[model samples]
Target chain A: MNLKIEKVAIDGVLVRMPYNPAFCADEDKTLLHGGVLTALLDSVFGLANFVAIDGISSMATLDLRVDYLRPAKSRADVMVRAECIRQTRHIAFNSGRIWFDEPDQAEVARGAASFALTRGEVSIFDAMTQSRSSK
Target chain B: MTPDLATQQLRKVPFFQFLDFTITELAETHAAATMPFAERLIGNPIMEYYHGGIIASFMEAVAAISVSHGPDLQPPKPINLTVDYLRPAVKGALMAEATVTRKGKRMASVRTACWQDDDSRPVAEGLYHFLLV
Candidate 1:
């Protein structure tokens, strides 16, 4: 699924997912699946890592832990913001929170993840720059 | 719920349907499932590796199914989930097996592992905690 980026800064990113039946858990579509929520959290945290590393490198998740504080009510847009809390030479720690509507609203879930920085021939920044230059 | 009922309920989850995860086996304390490799499941398209989130989702679903089919007989609410990605999940069908370690009145714990080709070599593993209510 394509995640919508609401904002991106040096330290963090905010992503939004408008409720879709594909994201629902029950046949009745009353609840969003926890896996979908985890996917959102995971993406945001990964993007936070990108921002943290100045987009010079790419990373992959080593470990991710999520706590579901409450069921994410169905048919509501969900927003998540993730920030890199710490970084080392080869790893980054990130924290994220999910909300149904407003940012200040009670969180439906929270998560933390650690990512391993990958040294690759192509950096995300390089790809973006190349794409923009081509355009 | 009986194992059969829990398995049926698991199939109803939209994410499971989206990922094409099939519950291959369901027992009182254990559950097994499989996910076919697909382009949509790729996290690193350049590398063609399964997305970590997709793998975690698969593991979490299997863990939940294991608990749901246990003596509790109720669908669980996830309290927390931790996934450790040991290796890049390459292009192939991935299998997951989950076993319940503890089932209490209010909480339950499950451990799950996923493998692509070799059952002994896991690509990822997870520990899941759920609320029994």
Candidate 2:
């Protein structure tokens, strides 16, 4: 749950996670699990949408497509940079790539996702606030 | 791969372990699994809905398991995966069923569906393509 935020810009945000045993596949501990990379891409894409919409609405992923380009090396930090490519009244389109160790590094995976926007409702920021207050 | 080997492979996946996914059934062309509800798996903590990515991961795991148990007897590497979220997954156990639609020398396709309580209403569905190398 400790996702390190590396940078936040108008276009996108960069997030990173350190390699951990909990994130490795059993078949190959030396490689990061594909599911973990998928989750990271999803999270970063959502965050990018949040930034693009200025936290005005809540969004949910409608569909996501991920292509695995390469296996992530274990004991390295995985980084994802996602941006909101476009937005409509009801949907936000996002694209992102995941890499190990550095931003300019070769990508481990690339993904695209669409999120449904819920207008005039509790947003993801609100949920985070509520979660923090309840703790 | 045999059913037992497929199960062992599932156990080896760290994300599966993190989600506490259990393989319920395994066969040549079909596979099934279950994920028990846990607070850590929640995406919207306030709404207590399961994470969309986790649901996708579950479906992908099932698809991979089905292909692994097929005639190839080797776990295929994922080439691509597409997941559709049909409904918000509430706090409860989730079930997934997957079937290999086509199998070839180099590639295979698998479709998977996940439902919480009602099988008719799926929470998520996905198509996975794998490279059998």
Give the top-scoring candidate (DockQ): 2
Candidate 1 local lDDT, residue A92: 88
Candidate 1, DockQ score (0 to 1): 0.69
User: What's the C-alpha lDDT at position B16 in model 1?
Assistant: 73
- All candidates: CA RMSD in angstroms? 2.9, 2.3
Q: What are the per-residue Cα lDDT tens digits for candidate 2 across B3-112?
A: 55556666656767788887788877898888899998888776789988888877887888888764435567888899999999999999999999998989999999
Please, what is the whole-model Cα lDDT of each candidate in the order they appear?
A: 0.83, 0.83
For A6-108, candidate 1 gives per-residue lDDT tens digits of 8998678998888788778777886888988888888888777777775336787899999999888756688899999998888889999998875557789
The residue pairs found clashing in candidate 1 are B1-B73
lDDT of 1 at B56: 85
- Model 1 superposed RMSD (Cα): 2.9
- Best candidate, TM-score-wise? 2
How far does residue A76 in candidate 1 sit from its true spot (Å)? 1.3
